[model samples]
Target chain A: MVHAESSTFAEGLTKEEVYTQVLEQASALLEGERNWVCNLSNASSLLYHALLSLPRPSSGVNWCGFYVVDTINPSQLILGPFQGHVACQQIPLGKGVCGTAAKEGKTQVVEDVEKFPGHIACDSRSKSEIVVPILQAGKVVAIIDIDCAELAGFDEVDQKHLEGFARIIAEGSDF
Target chain B: MVHAESSTFAEGLTKEEVYTQVLEQASALLEGERNWVCNLSNASSLLYHALLSLPRPSSGVNWCGFYVVDTINPSQLILGPFQGHVACQQIPLGKGVCGTAAKEGKTQVVEDVEKFPGHIACDSRSKSEIVVPILQAGKVVAIIDIDCAELAGFDEVDQKHLEGFARIIAEGSDF
Candidate 1:
């Protein structure tokens, strides 16, 4: 109940399972030693762990990342934290999904990555994505993003759950 | 002595006075009623307080602000917690002093706003400028900037102190 019950190879899981898993994982990490210093990291590891707690593990997302705008390099988003393949690190702010979202302060859900413009294919198997902007006050501060190896993987349910996680991040960490 | 004695304005304040003031402020705000949150505002307020902490009252710095790369808007840096008149709310990543420093990853000093191309004029009264990008994991996250009403007002000493304040902020806040 504290995690997504299904795996990528299996069918999806129930929503309750997904929620329990996500909360349990986050609570553990937040209560752990690294929770305080974890922000110093690329920060993707924490988000990945949180996602793993979902009940529908078969949503098939294996890669996750957090992107922050580089104040020194205003034209790019510096990769903050991630748990996945080596991605296109210096993403142009207005170009890729990450960049465009960061550029406009909006959320982007791509059902198919291949069809997206300037899609940086860091992972050839990633077929779907859900990117949400972490907002502070009225502006965007960073993004919590996930990528799946399955097609049509993420849904409204995923969005709602992940958004819940994003709120926690916005409240707890300076991402 | 940790921070107060080392400050350039140390001569005007006794250690006891400094300790009493800080303790009083901390107790009044942190423990009593939580007024320090009002004290610990954005760069504009922090910088203003820092000036008050100095030996002489400061003027000329008619405006102060922070430019952070917008997490949602990747191609531009959005304005954040700051003081002064209404500022250019957005600066392109590769363009002006704020943008160029962010793009090039360095501290930028502009002796005259008129001399800097693509200089954004939120207030025509602002002349000289200084910008320092705060970085985390080799990535720029924010900029601490000050604009003066006079030319050639900022230098290495100012950079060091302002950077010191920026360090406190970079380490103190969540994001």
Candidate 2:
């Protein structure tokens, strides 16, 4: 199913079509564990893995990672699996993309990293990024962080779709 | 804002409006208490607090509770909270409105009690109900279980509003 060449972005697919596709695929994906309907952490790790398995994940994504702030120690975001340069695993909840996303419970899309308050350069090659918060009950629990080597790599499509995916997994979790 | 009068059906309030109100006021409710997030063991206690804070939360609700399958313990919904009588604390994940909502990750609006499968009659006076799951990442973390005292007590307004509130709180997280 590696179909980056056949991706809707390249093919210019309709929003309704995309919405239908996602809706149609929702249950199957949920049952398949892509949405991880039974668990939160494992499902997120699975989501990152699925993204990595996608075609051209690396070109657009300089890094793909998730971060969980230490439950016992609140000052750091322990790194989840990632594909990128050495990252600063420990950052305050108000610093950098991961931190801000966690702090605001809103997605942070940076088309220009240089303008961000405190952009952490995990990879100097990275030029833009998007960080979506994993919200639980209204507080920032974690974040699905993606960095792209290209500027303006993400758009409303990615925002709505990825957030939809996050909703599929996080909206009903126990942990 | 306790507007719903008894001896008659409450009508005209849209679920979307209730949901928007809940979302807009979420930060105000959950921002200060060091957060009320909970787990299976303390689930009831958390639900008790939520029931108190939710807008006019008592109008249609006779018993509002929280139930979680003791993941480590297995097969029983550990008791959490309620504004009324003692409840059947342990319920299977696939059984009642609570279980079904948790299992299906969809809101369950039961207008008739006799037709409800595995309907736990904690309150014989309650003839109708609505249940919404609190999801996180994509898993059923917890459920917002409400039991109403009248037949056909919950309408689409209740269902959609409850669902939206469940999603927002579960995602944005206050506890």
Candidate 3:
């Protein structure tokens, strides 16, 4: 019974609960969808809407999107599907938080972007960020990046859940 | 001086003035960028941020994006880069507003989507819409879609400006 509808996670749910639902909904939404662009597009929407449905006092997410490794220029990561304000179009492979994540093959949970050296402030409103590298065949192919407007917005729970989300995409997608 | 920054127009600026700046920024952003995906990505970002910078009480815009004619399935339009909430992925040509725009090779300015027969309610919050076709060699290649939350949200001004916007993309992009 799954359709193109954006699924809504229950309100006042814990971060882990929200992400669990997100993973399930994402799996359903991404079923039989092999187009990398199309999958990333829906994945961003899933995360953005699920997080926005959280209860009051929750740190609102300002951005959710992907930075995909450029096929033409293998050393750079170009902006992929995203939801939020305008963003930097490209990031060198080893520079910013996204770049570092890709380079080190690790998840970066930035508590405060201002303190993160070489952080590319694509939107000045983004106070905190979390990036999970999507690895395909031991190579960083893409990264799911999320930003919140409040300081210390992302925690280990978010990191853990988002990494799971990334694994699903990495394993499911052709890219 | 034209970096990847989103440009801002003045408050109370005329629609023509707003679109004039949009075209200018669009041209600046599209220069030497021939990739259709990259161009459409930045174009959507340009229009979204440009309209969002308008003054208070202005009819707020909810979604802005593109539905590109699928090369594999020539009779359908697939969702491209976009901002705002999640959106419908595919539209059979001539079925909905975006499809009709692609089928007719003209612009569709729907004052009230409720009255527009066959209007797909991808997002229920969208009250009005405008879709402009991007034509190449007299063939419909894609359509730029904008949605607003207010009834009668779009008008002749939007149709005129966005059509012009479409032309620039048609001529400027390699699609």
Candidate 4:
């Protein structure tokens, strides 16, 4: 699979088409690439570039990245490969959106960060966020974190697709 | 002071001018930002974007990122924030470009990764490499590592300027 092609997603593709392509691209990029660090690194870039190829109003995501449970300190999540501004390094379980998702073992779709209680403002420019936890053996091992500068940047379509994206990473990689 | 401006770099800027802008931008982004993770995260993106804005021939850097000395495993360097393909996660002290720079408390500039003995081939696309160790209190705390796809990608100009870039992060941020 040639994952490094210039045009991973064709122009004029519908939003859904773009996402399906992202999933296929994710699979191809992660195929036989089992190292957790390497997998997450590539996946983050894959999503970042995927969004960059999409049309405007759906393309300007400010950040796309991951936060993994720190094996050294299980009580916290440490920053992994990310695109966009600098992010919070460690988020305690149940603290911010990433933390809350990790603690609850679920996905968090924040239409606006300002309204989210106890939001950790790592980057003031991030107005919206979506976080999906990646589980291995029923234990949450990491969270796929994405942030956007626009309000209501994510919805059910994003939630559904990204959950699938995270699932591919969780099931395929050796976390 | 607005660091998010569209054209962060002015046109017709020399390589020296571009590096100076990078240094200044690092300061602006790090001002009052004490979190080492946040500082390094933004710094890596800043340099990545800075290189992208430079003249074409000077802007083909394949990777720009950091590797920190793993506190849990003091003898090893763990992957940190990066822009590029997936990289090797654990690099032992006194090994490879990043580890050698960390162990010796100096910079390692490799015109070719193939010729460097024991060079860990994390990203096969990275042909040239430069690793600058970040020191705090006479001890290497972390390293600023960059890779390029082209041969002899980095030179004395990058060395001197990036050493200064690493110094600002070390002295300005609370690691």
Q: Ten consecutive residues with minimal summed lDDT in candidate 4 chain A? A: A1-10
Alpha-carbon RMSD, each predicted model: 20.5, 20.4, 2.7, 5.6
- For model 2, residues A1-175, the per-residue Cα lDDT tens digits are 1111111122244543544454334333344222111233223323333343344422366555566655756665545433333344356787887788888788988887878998777567677888887776876666778887778766776788778766765654433
C-alpha lDDT score of every prediction, in listed order: 0.58, 0.54, 0.80, 0.79
Please estimate how well model 2 matches the true structure, expressed as its whole-model Cα lDDT: 0.54
- The C-alpha stretches of model 3 lying farther than 4 A from their native spots are A1-10, A55-58, B1-10, B55-58
Residue-wise C-alpha lDDT for candidate 2, range B45-95, written one tens digit per residue: 223333333344335556555554455554544444333333453567788
The DockQ-derived docking category for candidate 1 is: incorrect
**Best candidate per lDDT, number?**
3
Query: What TM value does model 2 have?
Result: 0.40
lDDT of 4 by residue, B10-87 (tens): 777888889988898777777764656656766887787777677644577877888878776799877667776545
Compared with the true structure, what per-residue lDDT tens digits does model 1 show for residues A34-126? 221233121344345445545444337666767666666678765554444334445678876788788887778888989999877656777
- Report lDDT (Cα) of residue B104, candidate 1: 76
Model 4 error, position A114 (Å): 12
Interface RMSDs of the predictions, in order, are 19.6, 23.2, 3.4, 5.9
Stretches > 4 Å off in candidate 2: A1-59, A83-86, B1-175
How accurately is candidate 4 docked according to DockQ? 0.20
lDDT of model 2 at position A78: 49
- For model 1, the stretches where C-alpha displacement exceeds 4 angstroms are A1-13, A24-28, A31-37, A40-43, A46-59, B1-175
What TM-score does chain B of candidate 2 reach?
Answer: 0.70
Model 1: what TM-score for its first chain?
0.76
Worst 10 residues of 2 chain B by lDDT: B1-10
Tens-place lDDT digits, model 3, residues B1-175: 2233565456778767878899988887777656676677778878887787775223488888888888878998877888767677678999989999999998888888999989888888888889999999999999999998888777787788888899999998887
